[model samples]
Target: MGRHREYDVDKVLDATLCVFWRKGYEGTSYADLTEAAGVERPALYSAFGNKEALFRRVLDRYQERFMNHIPEALGMPTAREAARHILFSSVELNTRSPEQAGCLGINGSVAGSDESEPVRQALIDFRAAGETQLRERFVRAKAEGDLPPHANPEALAAFLMAVMHGMAVQAKAGFSREMLEAVAEQALSAVPGGGAAPA
Candidate 1:
């Protein structure tokens, strides 16, 4: 009989996320993954197929671990509160991690082109889903008369998305958590009547 596999699949994928998050998909190699994951190359190939397949798995796992909770954060009592939480959480995510990979969605996707169409599309889809969730929250706020009747939920969502991606880029450039928090505070201040603006 063949030798039994020893490592956990979820653990391996989690490690793979760090490798790809820090290096990007194209930047990471088989040796990089193997070393980071502490798994043999043969085991990795057996479990994840190829490099692209492994990267996709890593993305999916990351989404499950990180992205899925975003909607819950947006479920705060008010739309503005939810937006603040999302922004602050993103800043925290980038700064708190020792890996300093930036936002995987922003760094990996924005850097990719037609040659990396599949990965790029995956990132776009993830962002679109996030925007949709944010828009719905804004729509609920508008219905509650918390926002101006003319406020467009879709536009607000798009603007927030842009701001988020900008933060991700800046974080990758080594901006500190304090700087990111200041940016978030300014963005939050721009929201109409969200209490007193930061001093």
Candidate 2:
């Protein structure tokens, strides 16, 4: 081996993620990353290339870990369960941690300066991938009679994605978990053949 590393890369990435989650990509600074990640400037730069590269890695980590709930919901036995689970779980995920209250991807990319456009687009693409999967899942559900015959799977997918993202926005605005759950319940109840509204 050429050299031994002193830091746990996973811990560093997690810390950096918390920083980016609280402060968007454009708002984060070199000092923020170094202090949060505990890697120092030189070592941080040498290992991760630059802030942009490091953020991309952070995004990957967020997707792999924090976003598992989406996939878990999508894999539910019924489409209605999928919808309800995703919406309710979104509220839990967004509000579970008080300090890191909002979504990392949304928090990072909502406002991007020109210099951070690439980071913004990357986040957009990541979000779109989840939406695409949701659409496909809904289409299959419709075909399997889980959704009403007249319901449009594409529109349903878009609607759910909108609600999900809106939960993120609401969470960032300091909405309580119960309040967000009510929103999610209303969303799921409104879905065509989605089941009875939560009581």
lDDT of 1 by residue, 61-92 (tens): 87888775487767677667777888888888
Regions of model 2 farther than 4 Å from truth: 194-199
Best by TM-score: 2
lDDT of 1 at 138: 85
Q: Write the per-residue lDDT of candidate 2 for residues 1-199, one digit (tens) a residue.
A: 4688899999999999999998878889999999998878988987899899999999999889888888897888777888888888888889988778878878898654787889989989988998888889888877778777898888888999899888998999999999999999899887776443222
What shift in Å separates residue 64 of candidate 2 from its native position after superposition? 1.2
Please, what is the whole-model Cα lDDT of each candidate in the order they appear? 0.80, 0.86
For model 2 the local lDDT of residue 176 reads 94
Reference-based TM-score, model 2:
0.93
On lDDT, the candidate that comes out on top is 2
